[model samples]
Target: MEDPVNAMLCHHGFHPSMLAWCSMHQLNLGIMQDFSGSAILLLVRISFFGNYNAEDHLRESMKECTRRFKDFCKLHSFECSQCWLTTGMLHDNQTGWPSLKLKAYNARIFLMFVRAALQAAKSAREAQGLEEDAELSYAVMAAKALCSWFALVERAGRYLTPEQAAEQETAGLVFLRCYTFLARLAASQSIRRWHVITKFHGFRHILQSARLTLYNSRFLHTYVDEDFVGVWIRLSRRVAHALFEFRVLCRFLLRLQAMRTVDQRSVPARWS
Candidate 1:
């Protein structure tokens, strides 16, 4: 294969739509790009002779990439962190990815974010002039949802049977990942009134579109055998849940906006 960096850049092509696609698919484009860069360097480190030196460097580099990716996600919002698991961050040495350990670490961060967001929301609500509680609440929900996702993934990893392990390594663990992302996003959106933001309309819409694409994709129909009925069902369920949550969020936002309009209009025209 080509250098990981080159491979990622080639695959993703530096486009916003590509980024959206990554998000829709629950891929971590930024972290994936980072690890692809690190993977190339890992190959170089492997060429050296000292076993300890190479291993040390590889571990450090891997952890560094993960830390940077996590930090980036925090900077942008936890939504992107949820994307990292399906993205490039998953490409590390299967035995050495430190997934359970990472999950524990992220869980702590997630709780911290939850507390901070709640505090901020309380402050905003008390301040009266600032209407930022919606956004803060969303951030908290995103962090909590991410923590829940990591817990699920860690559980899946810890409890995997031999057959499931083989399946994970092969066609990839699509159900767990896609489901986690959709569920997390839905939960966060519900908490944050994120659906109130017009720009985010496409977010839920894309998941709906992806469900149709995957269900009808020639690649799936051609490749997935009847024997894989279980996998098919799981994927279908994930898609359905995602779409259902999206609809609920849309309705909730519509009602909220309508109420806001009514409240604003109820006031008398004359000054108090």
Candidate 2:
């Protein structure tokens, strides 16, 4: 290695393998792409003599699933109410990844994705004269793999049993193989938006990180920091620019103190 390169900070100078990734982000990206990627869309397209469209069938099924979950969320909003789920599960591919990740945190989301895929496959089977629908089968398999991975994620935040660690490794491997096949299918079909990228490789690293600890610990992701940034963005937009940084700090601190005061259990202070 050259001296100049060695002198750089650890993060900027490190090998690709040395860099860590956000597990939550990677999982959500892959899951989101599976349902909405052009490859999957092409695979879901039905070419039949009649008016039945498999893609439309799948879409409606997903919407129905989302509606059911939305109803459940109304009664228990704190546990599962996410903006994307409340509106509809089909988020725009352009700028909706954050909202998609928030939806992914809700476990009922798996039912919608997997249910729609399975229903589409079943419809293809019931179509009278069609041969084996390999593409639909591929979508079904990928969706199920995603469902399996999501279930694994929902098991526990930290300190998994040895059995659970083994399951995580197996789920990661199956998820990779399913998506690699879909990428190859995309190649054969000349689909434009479904090529594999390095970000997907982080899932294995996530599996490693998930099993690395020996005991209970806080979650690896810094969601609180993300929440703080979101709050600041809203605050900055609404406030005047003068003393911007100081105002933000003071207001943030005040908000925190007020929250604590409102929630505290001590008797209210009285002035005699």
Candidate 3:
């Protein structure tokens, strides 16, 4: 009899069906199963929220999921095995499955950022009901979270091997998603904050990171399914363009404000 876990591994990296199978069987398949299951559940929850206009209850559930996943990562921090007996033929004792481990770690990091983004968004939204000072406090919290996540991504490169870093599909998707989130956050702030232009530099950093990830993943077009690759490319390009345009608008607004300030000062001097 074939091991069910190995069967699922052969099918494709990790799929909903694989998670379902493990859930149905009540299997204790260790860290791989746990991490894959949590990641898939997070994806499912994200899909359920659709565009992240989530209801309060849905947001709470997302927070709960994030907490669970974080705890799981802490507990399993030292557990980095390439394969298990349950993986059967999929277990290559030769190459040692370093790529798989890297993918899993990357997924975990992606989830962490997503969780933080959600929390920040929620805090900003709730700030609308608070005092003026409270609102600024919440906005500052959101900005800090966004900056921290961007820095985390920069530091994450040290964790990857050259080959794992080159596997664009895995880490690349995470980068694209994070960049999109940051762009959206910037757009929201620009609507209310006149001084938001100061934050444009952070968006620029995310855009460059997204571009680098997409560039490295260009080879994915030939190897991956054409339709899937096309969709990824389109979404990435759309986000990149949106961020670029917003940054330009910010600079333009700042320049106009500076010019107006100089004109007002000169008018007062002429009157004097």
Best by TM-score: 2
- Candidate 2 CA-lDDT value: 0.54
Cα lDDT tens digits for candidate 2, 148-189: 766776654455666776676677677678767767876797
Is candidate 1 or 3 superior in TM-score?
1
Clashing pairs in 2: none
Write out the backbone clash pairs for model 1: 28-87, 32-88
lDDT of each: 0.37, 0.54, 0.37
Instruction: Give the per-residue lDDT of model 1 (tens digit) for 1-272.
Output: 76455555665457533333323112222222222232223222332212346436555544544555567557956653332333233333443331212232343443433334344444655677655434334334444443443343334421334443343332223322433443355466542111122223333433343343221111122122443455444545655465776755565556446645322223223312
| Residue 98's lDDT in candidate 1 | 16
TM-score-wise, the better of 2 and 3 is 2
Q: What's model 3's lDDT at 206? A: 29
In every candidate, how many clashes are there?
2, 0, 0
Question: TM-score, each model?
Answer: 0.21, 0.56, 0.19
- RMSD (CA, Å), candidate 3 to true, equals 24.3
